[model samples]
Target chain A: MEHSGKPNKIRLSTNPTNEALSKLKIGDIVYLDGVVYTGREGVYMRAIEDGEPIPMDLPAESAANFHCSPAAVQNEDGSFNMGAVTATASFRFSKWIGAWFKMSGAKLILGKGGMSPEDYKKHFVPNGAIYLTTVGYGTGALLGRGVKQVRALHWRKELGLAQAIWVIEVENFGPFIVESDLEGNSLFERENAKIAENLSKAYEGTRPAVLKRFGETDDRKDELI
Target chain B: MISIDLIQQTAETLMDKAAIEIPDDYLDGLKKTASQEDGDLSSFVLQAMLENYQAAKEDRRAMCGDTGCPRWYVKMGNEAQIEGGAIALEAALRRATANATNGVPLRPNRVHPLWRTDHDNNVGIGAPEIEYGFEPGGDWVDLITVHKGGLFGTDYRMLFPSDGIEGIKRFYLDCLVAFGKRGLACQPAIIGIGLGGSKDTCMVLGKRAACLRVVGDKNPDPKIAALEDEFKELGNSIGMGAMGFVGKSMVIDCNIEVGYCHTGGMQMSVHAFCLSSRRAVARVFGDGRVEYRTDPDWFTDYQRRDTVEWNIPENQTKSA
Candidate 1:
């Protein structure tokens, strides 16, 4: 078990080097300093499935692909009003993740919940990427404060504001924990194993439902994702 | 009659307040839970959340980017009237929702479920659901906005009475363990359990049990309240915390609400109001006075009355 004291905190550029990336381990806290862009199903669908031309430079501009739909709007004068930027759950985007890494050269994927261990091994490990899950899952105001400027916003007309690609310059821009490391280690999975040890005690004397769903797994260890 | 303009104005302010401020009851509960949490990663996450709340208030930004699907829980007295009737009141709320979706810059989360269309404003067909409740007397209306996160941590099942309390406990543990794994439910949450009623009402009651009630409040029924206490302890005892870490802070509080169901079934539903349990309430009086508050105080004695007719007790009577 890790100690109760504060975990190690490191500040890395959004476009981090291999050495910096390699140093990250499960549960290490991270803050990014550079540019990161928002992209989820809409952006992924447009770029990968719809065969649209990519707008921004790949890793040269920003290596962080945030699975996010920020609370933001485009003003009538063509500017943006961006507030409370938080990450959506990344597990739902597993299908598009591998192609996203290959096309975008993204070294970092920031989101709410981390992806599966299989995803870390197949998509993340091969593409030199790691997952940083936003702390509290709702720390949007704290993360929003890190935005120094809204550098660019694309596809507002095509994809709508929520799903649009929002490029922002940031400093001290996170309280994200490294959910996955370069070697495909997963913090959530490890914690789940530890928590699973006590499930029987908690479930003692409780009777299962008489009726059952079609494909429901009785195994508590089996995750929905 | 309460002013229509005041209703719109107050509703918009509520939209902002609900998104930005973490209610005091939930905050206090979380603080206590955080202090007790011992897991290294979980403790850190709790502390960060504490700081994040302060950041949200200080900066006047929405506490969460997802901002949730904004909904209204409106309760009025028998004599309460609006400047324009219920039709105008509905329009005002829809307008308030749209204006605030851009004004607070809340995520336009209410999209066309199938077409995936966006209005940029949160106003859409059957969007920003408005539910109504009524009290016995007085000339006031309460406008409560709850921007509840619309994903994971909610489920329902039909259980026969033969399954008993044991079945209830089993289902409750199942939900907490399943969604709690990835911290998808965003625990240490306020868990609401609806143990009876039809399927639709079961969902509604469970959701209200989660969203409308404040932390630490108990049901009037002694037995149900004891079960609530037991369920709360049971949830935290799952050995899970924030982000599904190895800790004991999975549940801040557990609430149970019930309704009479068919004799054959004990329909059950569980809903988890997430870390950002965003809710704000305001009471508008006929005399143009508006009072703002956090506690919805939703489940009054009348709301849960078991008798055929609601007979007002002398001390509890409201002014005409």
Candidate 2:
């Protein structure tokens, strides 16, 4: 097997400092320490849309906000069983992210597919936050191994298990790549630009469909998200 | 009669297996794809996935947090009979699905489309859909469960016969490039193409092609098989790989399933079975024998037969 050079790897605290956050670059591998929490559309709708007070301390308890719902359950005996944990697509959460950043004081956003560059430029840059995307998008077991303990779970009744807030203490909880750095640079967009140069070559012998969708782009460079 | 208890038990086991273990054929295909991958980031992603599979098996946890939508495909022999008939068999499968959702701790991915009501057990009205098929003979029942990630990497388009092969290639590329950016479709996937069926059946055939068939398996028709090979190569040549990085591992395999359609409409749908590619299968017999396997073995000659009447093969009839 051809072994390409590995990307630079670092271990950072979930509650990171300005100096610590500044050192990150796009495509660098990252492993997180300390505490992180799961929050997505459910949390967004309630905490932001419905104007519900956040149940925990902002960024103090956990600065890393993960767009995830673990394979987990709340036992009748008042305990939690969390197995594999992985991220969902972050793009869908873009609408409420700016408000989320201000309200939560979140410094790190972790998820599956990274958000658009416009999001990074607007919300992430102003808030001194960066984005780390989970590797393979299915490395749930590996990420699960990083959990030291389930600290707490919130909103079980109101939001249900999948949308409930899961506060977790983690050790080396990652295999996340730096998708966005402090300067608002996006690794995915960078890679997409490079890949676009060769797309025409790939689409060499193909022809467009007879019937077209209402709002479809023929440009290979255009991205759905 | 096939015992309902066995059906439920086997189904629960299949759900656990589908969530935790990587099927062998897919693993091998990925290993080969990994070896050939040149993009550093994409290579790392593939390697991490390989390790993740091992971690899941060793720890008995799900490979992905979004454990997809769990669904069933049950194939029975002509002589096979369930203890409480088809309805009872369906209830057992639903029970198995709910029990395993908590037991395996699978994410409750199913929900009411508008109300978004979650049962928190991966089961509700029409949830964990159970599809069926039947063979000509024997008293054995095959149970297959697939947990495929529901979002992204799938699309449908209606094309005329005049649009031809080039049109198919174009739409395929469109789905790939659109979802491929930022790794939405989760490339390095098993790409299933369904052509010629009406809209709904086109989606079904494509999904079956991707989820039911094993890696390296091809269509029985040589011409279709050839197209599968060509499409696989064509997909990998798109200058993308795992996570949409610059590489050549976008497709682990490409499978095409076709059905008769209106003479003018060449309906097409594309489905992607992601890196996790979760599926598991087992067979239960009237003799109380049970066996587990990875391949679904779904598209038999009889299943794909075009004629109205099925003539039992001479060799098989003589042996019987």
Candidate 3:
């Protein structure tokens, strides 16, 4: 850590260099105080599977691609004013997630929902890429506040905002969770096991006992709630 | 008579605002859940969410970018009159959707189910779903829009009429445990349970309860309302906090909807809504007055009664 900071908010004082991210473990809460690119549903597939060149100028050799679909408005001057870009489900693009990581030398991939655990064990650890889950759905627009500028490129009109690749400049971005890390760790599996264990213990109790455990606060004991 | 222009204007307004405005009820629920969050990580997740809400509001931008597909539930009064006939509602919705797609924009989410031929507009066959409900006496139309994100799950089961509440609760818990424990489903979500209907009807009702009803709204049925109050502790007991970051408050609210079915069988199901809870309503009067509503008051439209007082602290550890 470059500076002592609040526990609730860990500041990554450096760019998310591979060497810097190497020390970061699963479950570590930190914000990326640096730049990341906004790729789309097919960005990885095009670059890796189709052997297409990536469309961005990448300020750095190593990068992070947040699966984003930012709504863009064309000003009279013709520069697009970007509004909102949020995470998407990773499962659809799981096939190329690792390839993008290895090819682009990405330290991180941010999106919504989960990716396959099989891929986590197979691709993420070896490639040194971590899958981070971000706040998605209704909050995408607010996330746009992190963007300083958005430059649209190749297939910008054909693919529109959702599928088009964009180079986004970000500063102090992210409150995303480290769901899967380069250490071959999956928080999804970990939390699943914990909940499964808790459920087992919960089921062992008698029905009335279980009800009493949670329903103790309710006044009407006769109710079937 | 309400003008076609008014309906078009209403749809256009809803198309933009539905994705932008975080409803009053949902914001209240977020505050309630945040206040009760147990762990530092989970609490911080919520705190950041609240900040994002503020930022989105001030910037007049979408809270989250997904803004998913848009769906509308329109409730019309029997006495309502419209210019250019009833078909104008659909026409208005389509034009408004196109306008929103181009301008006060939404993500072009509608794609062909099989081939993925995205229309680039958030409209397609069987989309912008409009369900019509009628009231006895009024000259107005009420339209509620749920800017739906990806749905995580829908579950249904046939239960004997004799199966009763235990069976219903068990089914709901099973579904939530199986599908909702992951951060994929998000946390501090709303749970909706549908009871006493045919298989498909129950599933539909389950979705309505999940996506349409107000967070923390009680079911009219006393028994269902009681269960709604308990689901928080019950869901938290499973231990999936906000975004599954780990904490106590998994489900912040639950709403149940029930319908009568043929005597042969009773069916039940469960549906879940993520924390974003994006829904809002707008109404058009025959005289051409238009007003937007943040409080949907869905439960008041149905009658369910309960008299249970449970005031568990939000931060309390779920324990034996």
Specify the poorest-scoring 10-residue window by lDDT in model 3 chain A: A216-225
Candidate 1: what lDDT? 0.92
lDDT of 1 by residue, B52-133 (tens): 8999999899998889999999999988999889999999999999999999889999889998898988889898899999
| TM-score, cand. 3 | 0.85
lDDT of 2 by residue, B144-196 (tens): 99999948999999999988999999999888888888888877899999998
Q: Please list the residue runs of candidate 2 whose C-alpha ends up more than 4 Å from where it truly belongs after superposition.
A: A1-4
lDDT by residue (tens digit), candidate 2, A1-225:
224478889999999999999999889999999999999999999999999999999789989999998999989998888899989999999899999999999999999989989999999999999999999888999999999989999998899888999999999998999999999999898889889988999898888888887987887788884
Query: Candidates' TM-scores?
Result: 0.99, 0.98, 0.85
i-RMS for every candidate (Å) is 1.3, 2.3, 7.8
* Candidate 1 per-residue lDDT over residues A51-123, each given as its tens digit: 9977999989999999998898878897878889889998889899999998999999999889999999999
lDDT of each: 0.92, 0.92, 0.67
- Evaluated at residue B155, the lDDT of candidate 3 is 68
Superposed on all Cα atoms, the candidates' RMSDs to the truth, in angstroms, are: 1.0, 1.4, 9.1
1 or 2, greater by DockQ? 1
> Please, what are the lDDT tens digits per residue for candidate 3 over residues A1-225?
012222334555323656666666655665665566667565665677678777555436326777767666556686776666677767678767766766676667777755767887787778767777775334565568777776444565655556777666665566666677767777666666655555644333212212223323322111121
TM-score of chain A of each: 0.97, 0.96, 0.74
